[model samples]
Target: MRRAIAGLLGAGLVVGALAGCAPAASDRPLVVVTTNILGDVVGELVGDQVEVMTLMRPDADPHSFEISAQEEARLRTADLLVSNGLGLEEGLQQHVDAAAAEGVPTVEAGDLITPLAYADGDAEGLDDPHLWTDPTRMVDVVAGLTDSLETALGDELDAGELAASSAAYTAELRALDAEMASAFAAIPEAQRALVTNHHVFGYLAARYDVAVIGAVVPSGTTLAAPSASDLDDLVSAIDRTGVRAIFADSSQPDRLAQVLADEAGVDVAVVDLFTESLSEPGEGAETYLQMMRTNTERIATGLSP
Candidate 1:
């Protein structure tokens, strides 16, 4: 009986040890991305290597989005955090700082791209934060995201997997850039002018040889409202330039665009484009490539006779 009791105790110890030392199931690292655009880019690079949670929903404005308590919890627990980082997430900085203070790895994709300075005096000495407007710049962002993911997953991820994915995605973006250039080429040079709600497409316009006559918002940021003089000047410019379309961000209210169009006395169509955010799933502009394509096509149609 004494021998049997000793054997039973030994068996219990063995079971407990085995339970503690059994091969743990491989769980992917959790990565939290602040903007939907960065989230999509990171998702493309990481693939299934990491679990990605996007804080901003589709078509949500990055400058004004508020994080919930649950989102803060997720951020706190996240192994990595990705963001645009050039004053893009205007309202979410405190939360990001909190996450950073906790020693979570964070990446700013925009830092990899060559930033353009704001042309207008309003954004004095500030570089334009909308690097995603250029496909070449997006390649830089993908590289940064790949590096961040590799750091997180290390040997668990297949060697060169991130590189392979980045190459494929970069090729697609290059093709997209070519396609956009061709589409924009179709518009008459005289009419190849854009009037957006804000100076969001300066890089894009420069790349495709389109002139940005004026913006409804006087500044690069959407938070700034256009003054009466600003509106009057824009109206005068539209009349002089004969611009056919006034494009607006789909995420923002179009009351200003409508008012400008009504006052301009020209055929000013309010073309909605995915400027700072992607559309929801199943929408035409869900992906970055899709968003660019949709916006270019709409711009072409609206500008053409």
Candidate 2:
């Protein structure tokens, strides 16, 4: 009986030791990303190597989306925090700041590319945070992000895996860039004017040789309201440009775009694009690549004669 009790105790100790040795899902290196777009990109780059927590929900506005207390606490625990900087995360800046203060490593996609300023709008001259509109720029972001993850995660992440994944995704981005260029090149030069719900396509415009006639909101962020004069100015611009379609963000209400179209009185189409946020699965833009490709097709169709 004494020997049996000792044997049972020994087995229990062995089981406890094995349980302690196996890492829990939470024990994986945590990467807390701010926007769903960046989160998708990060997931592509890292695969199953880390736990990615995307703070912004699908179709949530990055400029105004808020996080709960649980998410705020989780931010401090992040091995690395990836964000779309350049004043884009207006509502979550405080939480990002707190996470950085706690010494969590951070990589901002805005810092990876040559940021464009709002050409015209109330936010003119401010850096545009919508750099992901251009796939070539996104290739740069993936490169920078891969480097950051390798440096921050160190032995916790496999650098070899990171490089392989980045290369594959970068190739896809280059293909996407070519695809967008080809599609937009088909738009008649005279008909290459774009009017969006907001000034969210400066990077896309610059990359594709399309003109941003103006935005209904006349601001860089959807959080800004359009005044009577702003809408009046945009309406006049649309009349002069003969814009065939006005693009509105799929994540935002298109009532303003509809109003602008009604006021334009020019049989203009109100096309929806996944501008800032990814849509829910099967709603067309579950990934960053999908979002860009969908927008490319929509824009090409909208502007083509």
Candidate 3:
């Protein structure tokens, strides 16, 4: 009888372990996102049907963030990998490429949008990777993400349900685009100038009729520093144009912006916007939509009288 009891106890332990290892019935597809912005977009698209994990933390620089060994393991097992693809994730390119080589489905959201070339003489000849600056572009990304989700989730996702949800989200982004255009239209054409730390907002300014007066770094990528001549040229341009505020990326250091602001002697408010990645959950700029809205409101407030 003691031997029989021991066998029964062993069986019970095995059952408990198996039960613990089983995923919940409602657990959705696993999605690993390379950046917070893409994470937010995927979260909205997949909703309750997918488990989304963002690699980059809030306010982390996309060009500099490195993935850990544990993160690589997660990537290997994730159902999908979504990234803000216009070369923004420069540091993680190798890992993403490896995932693609291993047959993991990887979606590059920037490919859906018509990329805007960086203005001549900006950082490293790199294309502006901050595509979400334009809300319309975000609508396109949402559609691409929806397609990727449907492909990954297969019959697990209801086709009609996903389509309807994507349509609703796209409509919201369209409205945001209109609202920003109208608000920025109110800024005087002459004063509609931007002096940012880097050339991250070339598309933004171009879309809204604002002039990119000068950038402290004067490069498309934020990984480079400005030479003495670059700083001198920016200072001269700022003095000549009478540009007001100098916008800075939330993830970049503010020392350069501060120096420019001090030298320019203008009301250079150090506006920190989510240019590279979204903020953490509960922050104002946590989601892609919120990030754009927050940036629009800030830019309008700064540039407007």
Which model, 1 or 3, shows the larger lDDT? 1
Worst lDDT run of 10 residues, candidate 3, spans 119-128
1-305 in candidate 1: lDDT tens per residue? 99999999999999999999999854878899999888888788778987889999998988889989999998988888998987889889899999999988888876888788777737756878888888878877887778877886677676487889889999998998889889989998998998999888877887889888889996878888898999999999999999888999999999999999999998788989899999998777898888888888899999998
lDDT of 2 by residue, 201-272 (tens): 888888999999888888888888999999999999999989999999998899999999999999999999
Give the best candidate by TM-score: 2
Q: What is the alpha-carbon RMSD of candidate 3 to the true structure? A: 2.6
C-alpha lDDT of residue 211 in model 3:
89
> Residue 33 in model 2: shift from native, Å?
0.3
List the RMSD of every prediction in angstroms.
4.4, 3.6, 2.6
Better of 2 and 3 by TM-score: 2
Strongest candidate by lDDT? 2
Where model 3 places Cα greater than 4 Å from the true spot, the runs are: 1-27, 122-125
lDDT of 3 at 194: 87
What TM-score, to 2 decimals, does candidate 2 have?
A: 0.92
Q: Where is model 1 more than 4 Å wrong at Cα?
A: 1-26
Q: What is the C-alpha lDDT of each candidate?
A: 0.87, 0.93, 0.83
